[model samples]
Every structure is written in structure tokens, then in C-alpha cells.
Target: MGVDQNSIWNLHNKLPSFPTLNKNEQTEVLIVGGGITGLLTAYELINIGLKVMVIDASTLCSGTTGRTTAKISAQHGILYDSIIQSSGVEQARQYYTAAMDGKDRILNILEELKMDIDIEQKDSVIYTEYDENIQAIEDEFRAYDTLNIPGKYTETTELPVETKAAVTMFHQAQFDPLLYIKQIIDVSIKQGLEVYEHTQAIDIEHGNEIKVTTDKGHEIHCTYVVQATHFPFFDPLGMFTTRLIPERSFIYAGKNENPHLKGMHLSNDTPARSIRTAKINNEHAILIGGEGYVVGKNKSSADPYKQLKQTAYTLFPDHTFISQWSAQDYNTMDSIPYIGRLKNKYENIFVATGFKKWGMTTSATAAVLIKDLIQKRQNPNENLFSPSRFELTSSVPTFVKQNSHVATQLIKGKVSDEGKSIDELKANDATTLFKKGKKLGVYKDEQEVVHVVDTTCTHLGCEVEWNTYDLTWDCPCHGSRYTYTGKVIEGPAKKHLKKEEL
Candidate 1:
């Protein structure tokens, strides 16, 4: 079943909003998003005595950062093995080191500020669901050894389900992402960083001085512009449409026997599950996450909540279900993020994106990398994630598949026939209806109230599928999900679908 407003993260709190840009503005540096990436960049720039301005399409931290699982770790599940094989031993080692260093930097900041945000040092484990991948897990262990990172290979895991093998990393961590972001924003503001929420950058005029034009007709003139808006809004460098594919991941929070796992954990196999624990006030909660796929690629099932519930029950039947939410992330083709300059063509314009599913650490790393680039300092990981590094042959298949799906949706026939009445919907079920040639998706909650919204997704105008597990309308093409009331629950859709009058 879909979660109501009782989410622990959403408890007793309203997000901070900043006024939209209304006129031409000037700053030394202009950042285009207010999430972790943008906020951190702004904060770092301000601390370095550079004037920085951050603009967001909505309230700060309301985007992907707010919905994140909030795990702060260098152990991006089963990635070290793949990185070592795909890139090289040195590149993999550097990546892991950079991530760990970033995690330490965040912890240092939290300690400096004396903020208590449920920060805990936990071990991170990567396990395989089936025995067929035992050798692969072993290979990953060997790769970790090459990096001198201590990881133990074991058959016993913390999950209630059985696993063949697992590799565990010690001293990893997780925290409440929203609290961390809010603290940073407050500090940045004190340091004279200008922030404008609900301000959307519509176009950019790149030259000696980059001019950012917002949807409200306001222009920001800056010597440097950072495209930290999850996906860069401009394609002058042709990055907005390529190099990365957006994907969706779901997470649910419930009370369980604490699993007492030493650290956060994830599974390497399909239907991946990420496990962690959090505290709401004084009570502990378990967060189980998995069931992710490339957007629009799968619609075989209307809901996966039952599967999550079953997993929780099987793992720790003694716990209770509390809060649940899902998040969407962008994945790059080569399994690495694209940071540094926008491209060779645009020297002053910078971009930070394509963190795959490890944004919490990668985004911080991006801030460090971009800050170094802006200050003309040497950063070790710059070439590793440079935007110009093109391995086209490896990415072409995914690019073709994703764009082909988008093209098909653009020209596909619309459902012009009227569909079922609102009264026909049952609690916790949703149906797509066409009324007078306008397509609508209606969902009835546990309270038997119907919330209607346009079935069309704001991103690329694709038809959205009903996600019963989260009780939201999901777009298959770009992984955009929205609440039944038409509020965008996830992105790369910044705008909400138009709500239908009930």
C-alpha cells in the first residue's frame, strides 16, 4: 500500500522556500540546483571567498536529496569489482578513496557543527541472492584486497533470507539527508551566498560572462555557471539528452527486529535490496530498499508493495511497518559520474551529474572537484570523470533503447475513449481513464477518496503507468513519479502533472 502523510521524514516539518528570481541578478558564481550538489557547491565557493548564488525550481532539498535513503558510504554495492574490471585497478582505487574521503569530510563537518542527525558508523555488506554469483562475489573480495580495503568474505548475513556469499566494509555510515542539507544551507546563507528557490533556469547564454535566464524572466550574470540541476537543463554540450539514463528505485521504512546488522547492506543480484536503520524520535526503524529498473522499461506489475512487505516479514516479522518512500536517480553508461567542465567547447560552464545511485557521496565529491577546478587547483579524480571521456560503443545500446522509447511515446496514439468512473476505483488501486479525449489516472486511497491527475508526464510528455507499490503515477520513459494529487514525488520531472477536478 502507498504511504500517507505519516512518514517519519515528513513529520512536523515544512521545507524552506526562497523567493523566485524576478529581475536581472549578478554573482561571481551561479548554481542551478539547491539540492546537495548545488548547496555544497555554493557553500564551498562562499567559504573560499567567492560570491555564489543558488537557484532552485522549488523549495530547497525538496528534490532527490530529500527523498534519498541518506546512506553515507564509500561502498556503492558491488561496484568496486565492476570498476576494477571496466576501468582499471588504479581508477577503481582512486574512486573508492575519493568516496571514503568525501564521507569523512561530511562527518567532519557534522562534528564541527555539533549536529546530531542519527549519524552512525555501520558496516556495509554486498551479498548475492543466488549461489551462481558466489565466484563473482569472491572476485570482488579479491579486488578490494588490491585496494588495501579490508573486506571479509562470509556466508552468514544479517538478513532473514539466505545468501551464498557476502563482502562487508567497516566504518561506513548513514544519516538523515534532509537535516544535513538544511544545516549546510543555513551556514551558506550566513556566509553571504544568495539562494532563490522556485526559480527555474530556462536558458543559458554562454560567453565571457555566462547569463542564466530563469522562467520568471530574471537573468543571472556570472563569471561561472554550474549545471547541478540533477540533469543539466541545457544541451549546448549535448549532455542533457545523452551519456546517462534515468532510473527509479523504491525504499520502504518499517519497524522490524533491527536485524542488528553492523552496517548498511545491499544485494548484488537483481531485485536488489538495501538495508539500513534510522531513528524517529527515540524509536528505531528499518529501511528496506530495492525493486528498481530503468524507467519505462518494465510495467509487468502494477505494484511491488506486497513484495516489500513479504521481504520485511520474512526478514524480521517482529517489526512494524512505519514509513515508505521511493527515489529516482540517473545512471551513466560507464558506471562513473560526469563532473568537471561542461565540455571542451564551453570552458567556463561546469556540470556535475550521473552519479548513478551513489549521489550522497558522489555529489560531495563533485563539489570538491568543481571547487578545485574553479580555483584552478589539481584534483586527482578530475580525469577519471571528465565529461569528454567518451566510450561510445559501450553506451550506444542503452542510448538507442532509451531514446527509441521516447520517440515511440512522442508519436504513439492517445487514448481518446472515456474510461471508468471515479466511483469504480477501489481503495489502494488506480486506473487510467480517458474522458472526452483527455487521459486521466485516478487513484483511490485507503480512505476511499479519489485523487485524479493527468496521465501525461511533464517530462517528454510520455504516458505514466500506475505504480501501485508507491501509489503514485510513474512515467516509464524518464522515471518521473508523482503523487495521485499530481504533486511530483520524484524527478527528472520538475513540474507536477495537471490535476483533474474531481
Candidate 2:
């Protein structure tokens, strides 16, 4: 299944195209990703009188930032109690403060730039259906109160489904992320920051001056490099491979009752549902999201599209269905994003990733932290999310569990072949039929060109499913995506699948 168009936030709006890097370039700061983190970091640095350049494998916002739920909130699903219990009261408090202040900073930027990004302050809520989790919810609320965070506890919710209890945080927000990013990109360009699309940074050598080589043969020499690629492109120093795991989530959008719910909402339980609204061409649209799982795992026996449609109908029977889409996110084992310096082993290189589905707020927070570090300023939240911090207790177990799951999937997928022909495929259609003992992906585009790629996801060897809406091969387990020709369009899969000879 592919992403639904209606749920996409203001993507129809046009922005200037960024030229691809074709020659050698030098800058004071080189940002190796053009998503929210990279663009915002460049925007901030340019304002502070630093020469900045941003390079992307594809276009801006085409990565996880473009596919996010776009909720800007301090309330990250049932985390305060867990963090306070595990990391101590001060650490949890600092985390909450950083996230809350990040939301404020977004609003401030919107106002300062007078950008119309559909920014709205709606209370954020986290609810759960299981009554057994009510005590956990209450405990989280108590922790919030103890930290003096502006939040409240409630036993009832406005959701179509019933819930045991919910924790509401005031002054949280939702917005059209693309619009916000467009404004920032424009400002960055005006401030003399350079952005290059279709520029894939293939290698990075760290020193007093960082050297970045692009697939297109362009070279970048810079005093500093920031890897905002969601998962660090360079993993040797950060151990991002061991620290973070990728997950996939689905979203469905359609028209709903007049102002369905007043605020943005998410659940505190597994298979979580998130709700938010947007105005598309003067019409209101509702986005309901759930059905998440780790990469490569098939949670449903039925078709994902049918499942999403049925779920939406169950929640809003009278509303008209518009569009549906899915997004991939990286979840850190410790629930904190890895920000600041890359690691103790590498200097002059930095990274910001592992937002755990809260990238909208956390990405902004990362920009602030990275910008501070680049310009030699100070930020209190830097150490809390530092990449060097190691929790061996949790890290070891997480590493084992993740790798074991991957190995299991890889071994289980070595089955026999059953081929299907391109003549039988329909437009915007895909299938995982076998061809000559090799599992092959078959996708027919709107133009009727048949695309053939290996069905195996380059990340973790999970079988890739056809997402008809997005016209990409989607890894059901970890949310990695590839162009029909087997190009690595998304990651934690940094490498593309080897193209199978037809």
C-alpha cells in the first residue's frame, strides 16, 4: 500500500528546485541531508554568518520529514514516567523542558517569519484503551506535575473509541511541515546558504576539515559536517546501527465530521493511533494513523489498504475517504534522540537522529543543538541526547534482539520461486511474484512502464511489499523504501539492492 494523498500536509505547494552539486565546493559547514534537520541547521547557521551547504540524495523533505505525522508536541506517548524511573528525575525533566521549548521555538519562528504553515496550538493528548495501563498513565501524569510541566489528567476522551484515561498537555501544536520547511529553505537560500538536491554523499573522512564525496563525483571540503540523514550515514563512531531500530507506521486520510476533535491525539498503547486535521483547498481533512510494526514483519493477513479503509470507516463511518500513506521512523532503544557531536571518536562531525516517531519536534530541537555546537554556543540539552552516552544494560539487549530478528527474517525468506509477468500488472500496481528462483518486485507506473527490482529489502533482508500509492517497494518490517529499480531511496538501508538480471 502507498501513502494517501489527502493526509499529506500542504505538499501541493510549490517551492524552488535546488540545483545538484556538479563540482567541488567548500563551505564552513556542510550538512549531509536536506530534510528538516539539515535545512533548519543551515538556516540557523546562515543567519549567524556561517557559510553553509546542504546536500540531499533526492529533493528536500522527501525523506522521513515529508512523511511525518507533523505533530509538534512535548507529549511523546507515555515517556515521562519511564524516563524518570530509568534515567532519574533531573534527566527526565531536562528532556521534557527541551521538547516543550522546541515547540515554542517553532511557533516563534513561524511568527517571526510570518509563514503561513497552518500552525495551530491544540492540546496534545495520549490515551490508551487498556484499563490495566491506567495506573501507568496516572504515574506519568504525576511525574509531569512533579516536573511542573503544564499538563492534566483525564479519564475520558473525545475519540470515537472509548479509552480508560488520557494525559493532556496544553499548548502543543500541529502544522503543515512542508510549508514550514519551505519557508526555512527560502530564508536559508536568501541568507547565502547553498542547497543541492540529487547529491548523495557517498563517503565522509573526518579531520580538521571534513571531506565528503558525492556519487556524482562532486567533492565537498568543509570545516564541519552534520549528518542529519535520520540514521547517521556514517556509523563507525556513533554505533547508530546498534543504538537505533527502524519501524513502519500507516496513515489514512479522509473528510470527517465538522471539526471532529479539538486537538491532536495519540494512544499510549501498541498499535497506536494518531489523529490530526488539516485544511486542503478550503476543505477540512482528517488524518488517522495506526497499524505500526517493526520493519519486515507482516502484522495483518489482509491487504493493508483494505485494512486502513476499514479502520477509518469504523472510526468515521459518515466521512468520505480521501487518501492514505505510510511513514518510517527510527526509534532509539533509550527513548532519547542521539544528537550533538557524532561521538567521542570523531570530532568536527555531528549527527541528529533517533526521534522515535516524534521527529517533528525533535528535529527542530536537533537543529537548535547542532547550530549551537557548530557556532561554539551552549545548550543545556546537548549532553542529554549526546551520541557518546552509552547505556550498556539496555544497549546490549536491544542489539541482540534487533539483530536476532533480522537474522530470523533473512533465513525464513529463502523460499522457492513462482514468477508473474509484467503484462498482467495494472497501473500503480505491484506484486512479490518470483522469477527464475529469485523473488522479484513488479511495479507498473502511471505511464505503464514496468519496473522490476529484487523484492528483498537491502536493510535486514526483509521482503519488500508494493506500495501502490507511493509507487515504491516498502519494507513491511522496518519501513525502508527503494525505487522500483532497487535504488536505496530511504534508510537505515544506506545501500541499494543489487539489480537482478532479468
Candidate 3:
């Protein structure tokens, strides 16, 4: 399984199964995911003596949180300047302050709970080797100055790679997120915060008390429900799918012979690259991530993993990568995350999504804002990140363009045909093939077992494509994913694909 189990965080933090929702339950709040956001939300709510139940389709931290680079920082890649230009200076400052507050919240929790994890404080650097991008870097520095953010504009970095310009944000941090979260799980359980695995929240019936129905046919009636799943699967608002687009990126980890870098580095370039170091098996290994593209729109004829592997080789010569994995993220139309009440009419329902790739800080911030909303308190960042706050001028064109692209992909998927006959397919490979004039997703295991399912996505009609690296059927439309055997893994799609006989 070459780069299949790519994230080192997942390798170290395998969790045991918790109970599933077999009967109806009631709570003050029902959190619909067990990743960092859900767990953190539950922890916060439970601290205030509210009865909270957190459920996941899988185990805790098994989603995108387990697959993250684990960089906790305010330097979200030339973001402040863009926010200032679009939303304004006060909003940008609030964004910066919220990010720092997020980092501090994590530390405060760890200290209060006495949780031991491999967390380190380091600077975060946003750099670019391209000369053309220097003005953007300068503009970001100016934004930093206006916001009074603790950062310095630098000419060089501790990165082994050469650079044209860099912005260093001071005292940022990195850690093994799962390990820390595991401790949170233990404390949360002890504090009467209920957790259920293998329990997928299928749909929510909004009322005075929201009723969340799970895949297992159990109901969780709660005063409030938080959609912490990476993509807001049950978008009662009918606007989340349109407001955000899913992005996929790759990460390669290997031992480096050079001196370990002191800072987390991200490139401000077209095809972005991020560098950070981690301790693996008692030795330091470098993690190089970033080759982002719209999900299912990987137009490059070359495999993305191969390209990232080559990048790792160039950056760390003679270093053999132990693991490589890919993760998916969603970017909002206006760039800022939506992290509050789902809609005005439905006050009991809330959502936290569109964190771009900066989930560590954003998710933490979201937890506080969500808690405040439920507790009936004022949060300074509420207006900036309100789920209903739509920026018509900037976001409308982007919303139309993204949806148009989705429409184009939907048509392209239906019309395009590039598949092999069952007899021609090699072992341990997956492809979209026509079987008896029907488009089907085909996967052949190493033991020569064949699995076939309808290539059409269950969420929307956009045809699903075979992801060779992760061995799943991915949708270009809304980022829903399915296993080769037609089981729904991620959603936006509540139902599994229709299975087909080979």
C-alpha cells in the first residue's frame, strides 16, 4: 500500500471502536462528526454542563483531521491581505486575532487537561521563489502591519530550498493532532460527553428541537445540531454546496539527511508546496505537501503522487519516503469560512465548514463561535463568518463559475469514454469501463476479485471517476466518495452507489 496510508498521524493513532447509536437518544446538542471540530465542540459544550453526544460514520479523528499536516498557525497563505481587500481591515484583524486565539485555545486545553502530546512551537513562513509574486507578498506584509500582527517580512528562510521573499509569523505551532485529540476523547467520555462510532447522520428534521436521523435508523433529538462533517452533508440551507468547492492535495513524508527545518513553510505559488518536519520512529522526517486541484478534475495525465514523489526526491535527495497520502478540503467562494447558524429560520441547526486547508486553527475558532451562539452570547467574529452572510459582489461570480464548472464536468463525465474491457484490466487496478453499454466503475483486487458499481454519483448525476491512488470512486460535482464495492465513504451522498454485476 505505497502511499495509500499517507498520513503519519493516522498510523500512530488507531482508535478502538465506540458504541453505535442503536436506539433513540436525546441531548442538548448533537454533533454530527467525530473529527477535531466535532470533538472540540463537544468538549466545549460539555465543559459548560450541557449534555452533548458526538457521532461519526467511522471512528474519531478518522476523517480529514487525521490526514492534516497539523500546522496550527495564523499564516493562512496570503489570506489576510485578500480578506482586507474584500471584507475590510477590521474583519482582517478579527480573522488574525481569531486564528491566534485558536492556537491558544488548544494549548490551554492541553494544559488544563494535562494531556501529553508531541506539540512544538515554531514560526510559520509563507515564501515564494517566483519573482512575479513578490508584490503579493509585500501587500500581505502591509496587511500584517495594518493589523498589528506579530510577523516579519524576510528575504530568506530556514528552508533548504532557495526563496525570493518570505513572511514569518512568530510563535506558531505544529503537533500530532490525533494524539492530542485522543486525550480529549478520554476526558470527554469521562465528563459525560457521549460518543458513537459507525453512526452516520443521514438527515435532520428542524423544529423547536432538531431531530437527526442516522443511517442505523436511530434518532438523536437535540436542542442544537452541529454539522461538523468536512462537507455539510445535510445542507438544510440549500446553499452550502453552491458556496464551497472541494480541493484535493497530496503529502509525502520521508527522512531528511539535512538539518531539520525550524519553521513550517508554505509557498505562495501557483501549484503550492508546504514543508514541515515531524519526529517519526525517534528520528526527524520532512513532510512535503500540496498539489491542489479541484476534486475529480485532475487533468494532468501524470499521477499526482508521482509528481509529489519527484518533488520529495528533489527536496530531500536519497531520502526514502515511508508513507504518502492525500486529503480533501473545501474552499469557500469568498475565501472566509462559514461557521455559525445554518440559517435564520432554522435557529437550532448550525454548520462549520469551508476552512480551506487551514482546518487546525479555523476549526478551533469555529468551536468557540459555535459554543457562544448556542450559549446566547456575543462573539466578535460572528458577523465575519456567519453562514448566512453572503458577499454578493465578490462571491456571486465565483459561485456561478464553480457551479458552471460542475455542470461542464457532469456533461463531460457522461459523454467521455475511456475504459478497458474486464479481460484487459490488470490486477490491483481501478478504472471506469463500459460493461454491456453501461458506464460502471471497475476495480480488480490483487486476488483477482472484481467489484463493479454504477459510475454515476448518488448525490448528483455527475459521473464518478476512479481515483487510482486511494482506490475510491470520486465525484467532480460535490466531493462525495464511494468504495469500489459501492459503499458510501464520504458524503454529500447519503446513499451508496448502485452495485452492478460484472
Candidate 4:
């Protein structure tokens, strides 16, 4: 069965279109992303009477924000146990507190605005059906208990499948992010917030005042800047490229009659599967998500989505498939997000990133924490999530391993150019070839047209791989994605891939 690549966000109202920054502008705070994180930060600051402006390289919600599974829970897959092991019990407790604060913030906004947004209060559970995995689940529950995090371990859950053990955090939530983000953008606009879509922030100039240079040759002058973009585009001294590791996960949603699944669920088993229920046209539906892999690992696939369907049908016999989408999330060297000043020197520049696929809760947390930092308010969670806080014990190994993988990918990308000759290439597909040792990416459009671009990623000097599913050339090194025709789609790379002559 052919499935379309649309996410299941049925937005009822048309969102306002923002313009490009054709001329220079100034604001008190310049937020350099338009996703959930950037917009939420704008809403938070603007409500407090700050002159804020947000800018995005592409259109709003066109990135990973549009493709989320919408799980608004802090149950980050047996996280507390690991957090306690890596950091301490206190740090684990702090993490949990911050996540709860984020969840409460979302609900508070919903209540204050009286917006429907299709939110539901459901228990978030992490369970394992395998006997070998039951111990880990038990340990996670114990960690929850030790931290006084109200959760329970049980053999039975709302899952249709059998579970040996499950850890449940009751009253966690899920909602349509598209709906919530629209309200965030709209409400912020009402408070004199300015947003520019399709305006990529290529570079930033540091001084007493921050000057953000855009692709359109216009600048945004502000006292402070926030790198709320998914992968920050401008990182000169932060070493973010070496520290951030990107992974992609796929999610499929299907129609169901009176969905049997009630609570948001994630399996602790190997090759995890997450299940949740949502409203589609006011009717019940189930979303099956999992099958995660490193960004450049799946250049060629034997169809993971079909495998997901097999798993879904085996568990829930009543599901009728409708739509599927994928999201890319970054993991920090440590598990926590970076949600404060970017650096000691660049104190005026703040950042919010590394959500680890749990952005639904963490994004709101980042927004509020950023507001506190900007206003110089005493926030309890401020130092806990700082960008420069380095946990060397936990982060060093991951940093080494992540960058080693990157170095290997960079080497492999430069060497592996064994694509079919132009005669064998097909329409709506892409491949990389070399001429005179210059690597070139080639694509054939549906209209029988040819396009080519330099296959090197503009962010770092790594080569790119073709993604047949998305019809783009994706960088395996730092998760920079480009259209088959060479336009930048996602970044740590702000510049477009150089177009090549056919």
C-alpha cells in the first residue's frame, strides 16, 4: 500500500504567512528559529513586553516540528535510571522537575487561552514484553520511586499486547503540535512579535549588539540572539558540530474505530515501538512510531516503514493505515538539553536545543527558562540546563564515539561514489557520481529532467548521501539536508549546495 508523507495535523484555520527580511530590522531579542522552540520563546518574552523577532530558514513547522508524534510526556524511555547512573540522584530529580514544569507550562497556556488543541490527559508508560528486559523496567520504576516521582510498576496496562512489566507515569499528555504552535505564533503576534519565514540566518556578528546576517543580505540587530533552530546554523566557538549527534525516527498514524489504546506507550524492548491515540476528524486513531537510526545510516533501506506496518498489524489488528512522517532529533553529549546562554563570552546569545526527541515537553521548558535568564530572574533550574555545563564523566565517551562515527562517515562519503551512470538513473530519484575526482550529486525529476549539485555539505567538509524517500541529498555528518536540486532544507548548514552544470 502506498502511503503519503503527510503528518496527521489537521489544522482547521489558515495560518498567517510571514515575509522574508528584505531589509535590515532591529529588535530587542532576535530568535533564529520558527519551530515550536523559537515561537514559544517569542511568546514567553513578548508577553513580558520584550521586543522580539523570530526568523527561520524555511517556512514555519516545515521542519521536524511538523512531524512529531506529539507525546507531551517526560517519560523519556527508562531515563531516570540512566540519569541517576550518569549524573546523580539529585540531577535526575532536577531533570524530572524541569520536565514537569514544562508539561505544566503547556497546560497552563492551554487553560489561559482556553484553546482546545485536542489535548488529552493520558498515562505515559514504558513497558517490556521480553523477560530479559523486565529487570530494566523494574529498575526504572525504582528510580522513579527513589526520586519521589509518582509512578507505578504493573504487569497490566492499556496496551493491547502483553507486558511482562510496565512503568507508568499517570496523567502525562499528548496533543497536536501543529495546533498548539499556531496559537503560539498567533498570540505572540498580538503582542507585537515579528516573525520572518524563509529567511535563513547564515551568520551572526558579535559585539555590544548582535547583528544576524541573513541569506537575503539583510541584518537583524538585537541586544540578544537565541539559537532556537533545530541544529544551530551559526556556531563558531560552541563546538556544537562535534558534540551534537542526530538520529531519525519514523511515525505512522492510522484510522481506528474506538481505539483500544488509551495511554501513550513506549516499549522498553529492543528496537522500540511507541503507541498513542489521537483524534482524526473527531474519530479515534492510533499512531505507531519507532524504528530509529542514525541520520546517515539508512542511505538505502529495504523499507523500514513496511516493517513498522507489519509490527503494527501484528499488535493491533484493527488499524487501517493512513499517513506516515519522520522526525530528526539531536542528542547532547549528556542527556539534558542546552537551554541558557550560549557561552560565557556570548552571554547575550542564548540557545535552546538537544531535545532528544522529547521536544514536546522540553521546548516549553526551554522557553520559560530562557525568559527567566533574559529578565535576570532567579530560576531554580537555570544552572541545571546551562549550555556550558559539562559532565565530563558521561559526555566524554559519547562525544568521542559520536565524532568518530562522523569522521568515518566523512571518509566513507568522500570515497563511496559508486552510483549508476546517467543512463541507468530514473525519474524522481537521486545518486552521487564523480567526474575528475569532483563528487557530484545527480537527480532525475518526474518530468524527465536532470539536476546536479556538489555533493559536499556546506556545514562541514563531509560528503552527502541521497535519500530516495525524501528526494533529497542528506549529510551523514551533521544532519544537513538538501533538495536533490541543491536547495538547503535543513541545517547546521546555511548555504545551499553548489549547483552543478549538467
Give the count of colliding residue pairs in each prediction: 6, 13, 2, 0
Predicted candidate 3 versus true structure: per-residue lDDT over 49-144, tens digit per residue: 999999999888878898889899989889899888887898888889899999999999989998766678999999999999999999999999
Per residue, candidate 4 scores C-alpha lDDT tens digits across 1-502 of 1113677873333457898889999999999888889988888998889999988887787778888888999898788999999889999999999999899999999988888667889889998889999999989999999999888999978766788999999779998788888888777888799988889887888887889999889988999898999887767775588888888888878788887566888998767898888875677777888888778876445566776787778777888987777778998888788788877568888888888899989999999999999999988888888878877888898888888989998889888885588889877767778888889998888887999999989888899887766677888888988877788877688788999975
Q: In the order shown, what is each candidate's alpha-carbon RMSD?
A: 3.3, 3.1, 1.9, 2.1
Residues 359-399 of candidate 2 have per-residue lDDT tens digits of 87788788889888876788998889988887765456777
Q: What are the lDDT scores of the predictions, listed in order?
A: 0.78, 0.78, 0.85, 0.84
Q: Per-residue error at 365 for model 4, in Å?
A: 0.7
**lDDT tens digits, residues 447-500, model 1?**
888788888888768888776666778776667678788887655666789988
Candidate 3 segments exceeding 4 Å error: 1-6, 256-258, 434-437
- The best-first sequence of candidates by TM-score reads 3, 4, 2, 1
- Flag the better candidate by lDDT, 3 or 4: 3
Where model 4 places Cα greater than 4 Å from the true spot, the runs are 1-4, 10-13
- Candidate 1: how large is its RMSD? 3.3
Tell me how far candidate 2 lies from the true structure as C-alpha RMSD in angstroms: 3.1
Worst 10 residues of 4 by lDDT: 1-10
